[model samples]
Every structure is written in C-alpha cells, then in structure tokens.
Target: MLLIHQLPPKPDYFRVKIWRRLQTIGAIAIKNSVYVLPFNDEAMEDFQWLRREITAGGGEATVCRASFVDGMSDRQMEAFRPLADHGAASERLPGTGKAPMNKRGRTWITRPDVHVDRIASAWLIRRFIDPKARFAFGEPKAGMVRFDRFDGDYTYEGDRCTFETLLKRFGLDKDSGLRAIGEMVHDLDCKDGKFERHETPGFERMIAGVVKRNPKDDARIARGAELLDTLYESFPAAQQRSRSH
Candidate 1:
C-alpha cells in the first residue's frame, strides 16, 4: 500500500530534505504528504524512521496507507529499491559484468547526477512503477526488456509521452507512489537497471527492518511518504535557493 504522511506546516526545505532520505528506505511520495510503498516489512521501518526524523527536526507528522474506493492495494508497488548507500558511491566495479558475481547480488551503480538532474531520476522511477513508462537502453539486457516492457527500438523522446506509451504497453493497474517516483525509476531503468545499480538504493531492505521492529503503524507509513519525496528530489542536484533556511 502507498503511504501518505501529513506534517504540521513547516518550511518547504524541511519537507523536501526529509523526502530524499526516505527514498533510501524504500518509500516514494505520491502526494505532498503521502508516500507509496509495497506491502513489506522493511518499508514499514523506513517509514517509522522518517516519522522520527521529522519529529526530531521539529515537524509534526502522521503516516497512513492509500487505497482506492474499491479498496484495492497498488499492484505495481514493487521490490525494486536498490541496495546502495551514500557512502557506497565510492566503490568500484569488478571491471567486467562477466566477472565472478557476488553471492548477495551483482552491484550496478555509477556516479549519478542526482543533484544535477532531478527531472531525469523522477522520470525514471515513475516509469518503473507505471509499467507504461517507455524505456531506451542507456544500458541494455535489463529484466523489463527481457519481460518485453519495450521494443528493441530506441525512442529518444521526452519522459511524459514516452512513459505513457510504456504504461500503455504494460497496462498499468494504478500509479501509486508520488508522481515523481515514476520519473526517478524510469531514469534508472533507462540507464542503470543493467550497467548501473538497481537504484532502489537499499530502500526495500530498510523498510523490511522497520516492520520487524514494529508490527503495523499508519503513522510510520505516512512518514515514509515524506521521506520518499526527500529521496526522490534529493537527486539530480540540491534544491535551488528556495525560502531562506
């Protein structure tokens, strides 16, 4: 279920900063105060951390689950969160994809312009969730392509339209996470799913940890949304000068 978090009125920077961190824990923002995450243990803990962080930072918050009128949970909310971290960015690849793979999993990330191009990351994640999000091979041999998410043709186009085409092909059930989630995931899919990191960035793992600590809590879920947004926008570059601190 996608989680929604509502916080007391605070500076926009506070919200955005928190959002970026939450994404690292596997949460994605769907609304300004709402985030979407798959049903899993790790995601819940991540949400809880977000709630605590925001509260410690002087922001009041509430986390809740998002569901349609029919009450159907988001089907595409996935286990796609990557396993890397901020410190992990300095690690080097083994020099070849065919080299001995790790028992855990092969690493796949490079220096990302998260602070340089937020639009690109936003577009990438959104596309991954939407299924309709179209893809081109920044790096080939991805699972989606193996699953036939896109034809073997290149479509150098804007994210909005091309993503819609991809969604049409996947037959999107619903768009859960923050609107920006589509953008970021799609960006990763275009570039990293193969050559780079999976790009969920250890979010899924963190979330599972959360659930293990706490069984169920709506407040944590809402906080997860706030954190996811922070993670989503944190990339592509730091925010431009907004309200003075």
Candidate 2:
C-alpha cells in the first residue's frame, strides 16, 4: 500500500514524479494519493525509495503491507496481470503471517564457493520466497531443493541461470525489474553473451570482494543479499529504459 501527501497545492513536478515512480513499479492508484502493489521485496523497496523522495520534496509518504484488501472492481484488478496460478494446492498454504510449505524445514543445497547465480538465488529464496529457508553447500540430498548445480531440479536449462529457473517456476517472472536482474545474473553466471547491463561488472566485483573478505558461505550470502537489495532498487530505472527500446 502507498500513502502520499504534499504541502497543499502540491507542486506539479513532485506530483508527476510520484506518479511516474509508482507507474514504473506497476502500482495501481486506488485513490488520490494512494496506490497499491502486491507484497514483495521489489514493491517494498519501491515504496521506500518513493517515501524518501516524497520527504525530500517536502511531502509525506508511508508504505505498508496489508493482510487483506477488498473492494476492487474488475477494472481496478486489471492493473496487474495475473502472476501465478493459485491452483487447488494453494488452498493448503498456511494462513497469513505463516511460512509456506516450501519454506518450512526445507534445506536448499548448492555448490560450495558460491558465486553470482548461487548467491543471488539464495538471496531470492530468503527475501521473497522463504523467510525460514536454510542453505547448504554440497550435493543434493534425498529431499533438497538444489540450484545452480548439475542434476538439480531447478538448474540451468540452456542459457538461463538457476535464479531465472526459480523465478519462472515460482511464477515471479511478472516483475519486469526482476526479469532484468535475472538477465544480469544469467549473463554473469554463464557469460554466454546474453545480457550486458552497465552495472554488471561493478556488481560482480562487489560480490567477489564480499566473497574474498567473508569466507563463510552464510556470511557471503548475507552480504550478497544486501548488495542485491541495492541492485533491485536501481532496476526500476532500467525497467523504463527497456520499455522504451
């Protein structure tokens, strides 16, 4: 949810900036000075950045998540394309504020000496998909979710990285900015002449620095997640660029 207010008779530039920012993140205006987007890391960060912008521009803003929202007409709902098919199995999901089945007691396995794809995938799992998810470095066990490794359920298929595979399988590819991030991860991981975002080299270098300083897998993952948050924040601008091209 988005809340915004400006010193009355708001400046036109501030108003347009807020609107464009929300539009970039695919938010739908629910009311004047209010907008909404599905709950996710991307949405949360988008709102945070907007809040800072608002405050800096002599306005007020607040963003929050709601467990329940109703009263949207069909047209309003059309603002966002359907994400995933919530099939019959989705009914078995835990109630709000609870961990889903995939996240509960699940051990995700990947190769040791984590790099771009593995670290980003771990960050994605922890940030968006699973809060209680645990990661280990090794071969896949009898009941483990393995990624970026051979013989894994969600390993690379052709040019895609494990992160891209997970995003598709999890029905999270709807976030255009995330798709851009996946492109960068794919190019950096496979180096297969795929995507060439200007930020790729610096991001990879930052990851290498983190890995060199923090030898532990868990430490590297934590540091990597921080970096991804920064990258994710920057992708919305790229989202606009991709649309123009």
Best by TM-score: 2
Q: Cα miss at 32, model 1 (Å)?
A: 1.5
In model 1, the worst 10-residue window by lDDT is 88-97
lDDT of 1 by residue, 79-183 (tens): 455554321111111111121212122122212222112222223323333323332323454433311112212111222223333333343314433333444
Model 1 scores a C-alpha lDDT of 0.39
Q: Which tens-of-lDDT digit does each residue in 1-245 have in candidate 2?
A: 45445533567865665565455456677678777766654456456655655666677777786644467644554457334211100001011122234655578888677877788999888877877888998767777876655445666543356788777767678887778888888766655445888877887789889888999888999999998888886767545755787
Cα displacement (Å) at residue 193, model 1: 20
Which TM-score value belongs to model 2? 0.54
Q: What's the C-alpha lDDT at position 146 in model 1?
A: 15
lDDT of 1 at 114: 24
| Model 1 / residue 237 / CA error / Å | 33
TM-score of 1: 0.30
lDDT score at residue 25, model 1, on the 0-100 scale: 51
